[model samples]
Target: MKKFLLSILMGCSLLEAAAQTAFTVNHGPYLQEVTQDGATIVFTTSRKAFSWVELKQHDAPEAEAVKHFNSKDGLKEAWNTFSLVRVEHLKPGTSYDYRIISKEMRSFQPYKVVYGDSIATKWHTFSTIDPQKRGGSFFITSDMHFDAAKLEKLLHAADYRTCDAFFYAGDMTSYIDKFEIPFTSFIDTSVKLFASSVPFEVVRGNHETRGNLARTYSSYFPKKNGKIYGSCLLGDVMVVMLDSGEDKAENHWVYAGLNDYDAYRTEQAEWLKELMNTKEYKKAKYRIVISHFPMVMSQQWKDEKEWVGWEDAIRKFLPVLNKGNVDLLVSGHTHRYFFHEQNVDGNNFPVLEQGESSAVRLELHGGKVQFQVIGVDGKILMEKTISKK
Candidate 1:
């Protein structure tokens, strides 16, 4: 009787271990940093220890117009559990069918990290939001790095469901250590709340400077530039997104001999000069630069890590926009939203500085811009209105 009882207990233990292993990987693949190119649905996905991963662009949620793709180095090696893949040149305002496949793990790796492991476990559909021409209102919120307690408190504070579109300026995940799991959860919540209905352009923040953070960032945002520094047009604005690549003093690649700040500036300087001359930019009524690092100093210094030599580089970058008649420079590292105005070449260019906060409320009409910084409990922290002379 004792031997028989012991066998059952051992069996239960084995069963529990298997269940735990599967549970870690079984969560639905989270999607965020959604952007649309024509009609294609471009977003990010992360899963664990699945055998194979492939992306198919389909007419229906289940049908296959598979525009399949593989990872950078294939999937045999384990980088981060997150992966990014984009379906090319889709139609405008169309719905897309996508599947993330996770096959059982083989004793050996499969397809280099291809479809072998870490993919969406099921099919999900995302609709592309209309472009600037079909102009509409979208919401901008920065620094919602998740804490269940904090998120729950803010969720209970207000109704955030009214906006037609949503934008995340950066720092989507607060955890730079484990790197994968936390970021995945943040995206899942946004999607669960139906925030994925419209296209969102995500910027790369300094926190994305961790080991597999870039890989994780790339995994979920494959559509971003092979390196995420470039310009895109959204409605009436010319949006220039720059990748600072973690440039605070101690933690950036600059400290590790990975990047030369001056060379990077020189390389991007050329692009900045040329892109400013592009037809879309020259013609657009609004030109905005979305960076993870704010263009100015924080309200009060907190620590050494909070300061970087970015101001010098930004000073170099701003002149091009000043010459090009750019309208606004917006960022979210300070966790506070502020609006300032400066004269560039005798023309007024508004500087909107922001840190990681909940949401920013703004309205542009009749060539006037007014922004309201609304915090928890409906308290209005700051508001500014700009009138064109």
Candidate 2:
């Protein structure tokens, strides 16, 4: 009888140990919107837990480290899995080693708390954007359409770690039909590539507006000011990210009476015009716009029947961009890659579009912009250097 009781006790102990080890990092520890003074790190754990980031100078002793957390709500929730921890007051152009720590919060109530074993990720290092750099490089790619295998392949091919930041222009997933797909297709792929160290700049594509989950897209990929469009200065380059809306009219039967993109775009235009007048926009030596859809559509879509909802954007945005004196525009929607140099429209900026499953790398600094497109097979499809105009 005594031996049987001991076996039961041992089994229970082993089960408890397994449960403690279950709090693993499912995805991320990916960097987002890194700036001179601050940076955002996002990640997910396998189970409900309270998470925080511990960091110090790359070469500094651990004793001098600080803990950053999304603990505004007290950090006592056991059901907190997705984490968006912002570390502020960081030195620009400096390196730091950081790790994610998750403590299983078993329970939390007014004045009462229960916690379980904790887990910490292996330490990783990241560099902040150099405030005074003469030039820096970044990677751009779009139109994944939920092709995880292709995304994983391209991440390896592009050498994402080498760039100062990474941009996904749009269509990272198809329809975003199911909320989980975006988590699986976009978030998962991004984290695996950069490991919360490289900055990521994401834009919204037409396909991202489809399906029921479309409305909840931002919950997964939150941006500055909760905006889909904004501008930031990376090194000496000013990058403006825009949301082009759906590829069809709001009244289009497919939208099913749910969309106000035209009005939304007009409002964005008003804001953009004001932004262009700001001292920051006017003073930047290099200005670039990253839109999911190209401002100048192809001749094949000239017919009214084939119109894919670009009228609102062109009519509302082109003038502002032209007046803003944007040096270049990077876009990706047509799947087929192409470059337009002041094409058919009365536009004044060049546009570079990436093919499906390809990546564009840009090295911007001084007064010159050099870029190259790499194919899925790791071949350079095109390379060019242009001066700021």
Candidate 3:
């Protein structure tokens, strides 16, 4: 760690201090909105390191490091940057001091991040956002698309630090084909600010569905979901993160293979089946489902070229959710915010549509839950309650 820190110091030293940018240590953490369960941490890649040595958090410049993801897969993408770090099983409702530490730098021949010196990065501390309202409240929002100004405005307006955790429904960027400059930078710079005081959670939006999206997703926010579908228990709420396949014409309309997308969804569905049956889930005060696309009624997709056949699979998945008595299904794909109260084949669930810069909160009561949508200005756009008990 000593050598790593010094290497980064030397690299930054090589550059004129006059031109060096002063890094706001807790400034921006996630390029995308940050997500946390108070115990598990998740975020996007925050730095551009070519070598593993520079990959180490102790190796990057303070101006360039908070927490970052380094991945070889990123090599083909924007500037070949990848690697998202996940520190898991952290103490709940506790504050911890963390110094960014990459796995290790393995190479430096062609793209020597630092000439000969190692990168010893700086250290900073952050308190884990308390899941329970004791520390503070939490917010839910998504679909920013690297709109730095809007994100910044949202954060500023929300005063993110006041919340214990934030949940992103999905769509952090406009596209994931290649990393865009400020988009990644937005996650790099802006997200940290949001997470530093309050942690956040994420669901993969359609925008993040391009090119090795899973690899990218796992790199930064590595956590075990036990299966493809994952769940996180935060305070009194249980968040189910679903890998809801794709909703494109080729995948949705045209005959789509029931097998191709099965790998991701099958695991998730099985996990959901068992999870919904668990005693903890059954008794939980609040339960919410998050996915990139919405699951409407029993839409049959019994065909090829049309992925609607896969719709059958989703129907199979819903029975479990219905039995579980889920309170809300949060999704973002249409890009427009709309809410609907529907009984999915007799199963009642509220669909909360995510819009860019929109925030939603779930307030729990003894026997029911209320949903309130907050605009970027912290004003409530809509409010509704469910007496599902």
Candidate 4:
């Protein structure tokens, strides 16, 4: 009897050991908010663990690699399954190899912390955006609405690998109901295809604002300003991303008094007014604004009742964009494709509304800006070039 009890005890210990060894990466090691001198790397582990990123120039020796972590008040963030490490002071347009390392935390007691086995990912490569470069390309699409298969088809329709970045105008999912919704819907495929190497920029849409996890969206896609709307300079071209909150008014019955997008639009307008005065905005060879909701609607929908959000955007954002001399505005909320000429519906710049089944590849080179709308079937649906304003 004593010998049998000893064997059972030993088996239990072995199982516990095996559990600790099972800790591994669960989701991403994808790039975000990549700029000339910095980038944010985000990923998740299967279990609670402390994580960091180690990187070096692509051709540099491994000995020269440096580690980075998300730190606050001189303390590194740990004991969390989600990891977002920001790396800075990188050279512009330079290539680097990076990997994620995590050490599982077994227990946490005052003065008695226990740690488990560690794991690291194989190296991945990326290049920082260069402000001086005169040419580049990026992919833009929207209204995916949780169709992972459709997202994959759209991505495959373009030469996404050669693009500098990927932009999802919004509605990647129907709603953020669960923690895994983003991964299961679109992010996992993005990381598999090109997001690990190229930056992924997302503009929040109306659908993304629903459900419980919606409030935590920024944790997954952290920006320097902590807001969904911002601007990035890619070479001589400036891309402005605007967050056009929910489609209904703050007091609408559907919102249940939890939204204040009207005020948010006013706030964003203030920021846009200031951005237009900056030298970077004035000097860029081309300026493109991306908003998930189109500032102007077709004549038929102009009088619709639930268009408070659209009306607010036009009243607040359109004036600023007009004065900024923006060359193009790309939007996708209606899921309908149309190209509105300049001065249509009070917008000084042209508007291109991307449909649910199409993606746009925008290329900038040698003082020319051109875009081609490609359908999920890999055929060019429409093509146009914009002359400098």
Candidate 5:
């Protein structure tokens, strides 16, 4: 009887151990910073695990897939919940199918490692940006403020699958108090719709700078040069994304002395100066700047005192952008739509201030860029076109 009782207790312990080792994907498997020959795949796991990505050309056989792990020097990234595996050396404008694989690490020591259950996601596909290809379309939206429903509506209204890239201009959430807020507020919705296969670039907004996890933003949306502001060549267009920091001054009481945007803007300005001189920027047929705040606001807000960040942008960034021969500046912050014409309010380029209710689709073809603002009800609210610069 004693032996039988001990056997039952051991069985229960084994069952519990098995249950604890069950692994699953928590969020992401989304594409970010996708370039002509490389892309970063980010995802999180339910438990500490070693993660990797299996990738192959879309038309290739499964047996031809290559496994990629996020590693440095001689060590592979392991014992972590978040996984960021960057796949490189891909062909330009090529379609590739990929999936994430994570194995739970039950225990790890210098001489021994125990692995548990592993998980692999269904295959997803994405196409790398082709710098030489002319005429591609992209969708842009901002200030959803964590309204997943609204974001989904906008994405559907835009028919997002047909676009080469999706740009979240800023403020997808009101604030990110926890790490999960990104996945819960917007990323999860995106993965459900198109993020697993389509590369989405996030431009930082003022509100995103307000939460505790704000510093971790880059970890999720890694960019070139390790900064939020940078330029990417998508198709034939050069898209420059800028980080418009908090709306108030750095020393504002509400910030509790944590702000330093004044200097940050200066740093961006210096970077912009050099970027404009780069061969990539100068050779592009079209250029668009995505800034959360309109550096040079309309005449109506020219004297507004509440926007110190805007003032700083005008003083620091406007001059560099003007000299860069930017064709358009797309921004969202005021929740009101306004199209400022070129040479208006000290801006050499046209500025499109997209409202919260609409998504802007910019199509480049026939030497012109056509802009259509689609509303939540799936109706076109505004349309405009600009010739190549």
Candidate 6:
């Protein structure tokens, strides 16, 4: 009898091990859209599994654990690989640790179901934005164009030792090709870096709107209100993120009658105008606009272009933005770095861009915002300081 019991126990142990190994984290645990009161965690699984995030205050007792499930927030009960869990009502500017929990689904059908053993990821901690904090820092890079090695190298050299959040101005991938290798490569690299910790803010580039998979961009990285442009508060500064549609005319032959950016940009410009009048914009100590393309660029082509790409953008948005007294505009699209001082773009703010091989690090504190353009070799290419006006 004892020998038979031992054999049964060993069989069960082997089965559990196999089940655990079958379901693995395919990507992420990456942080997204984190605010003072809430945050969203995104991850993918190797197999279709029911997943959730078990989180708690970093300093809370173990017994006070909170289970954040996607289903409770209107997500379906179907077996899906990707999981997005939004944890809400969290205390502002607080530290918390969380782990990804998943159960492998062998079969899912009406009235009959089969599930494997459950597994959990190792705990990772992150802090929400602190509204009252007077000092903080962030990192920004752009125009990666699907270069993972360059992405990894620039981030590694920057170190992110004191970064509160990370931003990709645009063009992380050349095109959204069915969420295939190119898209996954860009996301995987980002997940490896700040996914476990800081917030990952991404802006859409012109290239991202191309290919058959272009429309799927938001299904991966969703924006508030389902619009590509929105604003968020990072401490005392309000970061305005915009989507500059294709860098060419809507009626251009290359668009194949698929692009309608001129009207979209006009809609966004109207939204910006309304947003500028809000108390949130007026109360913030700093206002910064982040977009993929700049309103001003000196490089002009002699192709006798009838519909220049930026012409509509400048006509529709610059007038409203200039009236709002924007303190700074950070952008990337040309793949070449440059800083246009105040009034250079018919706007009162300075515009800065981080080129293909460099990253921008900004330190916000003591009434001044200090930024440095650091190359992949860990050398500072340019340094600029802006103070609160």
The backbone clash count of each candidate, in order, is 27, 3, 52, 0, 0, 1
How do all the candidates rank in terms of lDDT, highest first? 4, 5, 6, 2, 1, 3
* Per-prediction TM-score: 0.71, 0.89, 0.67, 0.93, 0.92, 0.90
lDDT of 2 by residue, 1-389 (tens): 99999999999999999877676877778877777877788788877778889989998888988988775556433467777787889899899888999988788778986888688998878888785776677888899998878877777777776776778899988786764687687677777677466767789898898887788877666566887678887666778988989877778898888989998898889989888888877777788899998888777776655455677787888988988778878899889778888745777888888889688988886678888888888898988887677
Higher-TM-score candidate of 1 and 5: 5
Candidate 2 TM-score to native: 0.89
Model 5: how far is 206 from its true place, Å? 0.5
Model 4 misplaced regions, further than 4 Å: 1-21
> Residue 201's C-alpha lDDT in candidate 4?
89
Candidate 1: tens digits of C-alpha lDDT, residues 146-166: 543444333333345655445
Error of 5 at 272 (Å): 0.8
- Over 57-154, each residue of candidate 5 has an lDDT whose tens digit, in order, gives 99799899999999899899999999899899999989999999899998989999999988899999998887679978889999999898999999
lDDT of each: 0.55, 0.81, 0.54, 0.88, 0.88, 0.81
Off by over 4 Å in 6: 1-21, 72-76, 180-183, 299-307
The best candidate by TM-score is 4
TM match of model 6 to true structure? 0.90
lDDT of 6: 0.81
In model 5, pairs of residues that clash are none
Per-residue CA lDDT of model 4 for 119-173, tens digit only, reads 9998999999877788678799999999989888988898777787789999988
lDDT of 6 at 292: 89
Q: Per-residue error at 233 for model 3, in Å? A: 0.8
List CA RMSD, all candidates: 5.5, 3.7, 9.5, 3.7, 4.0, 5.1
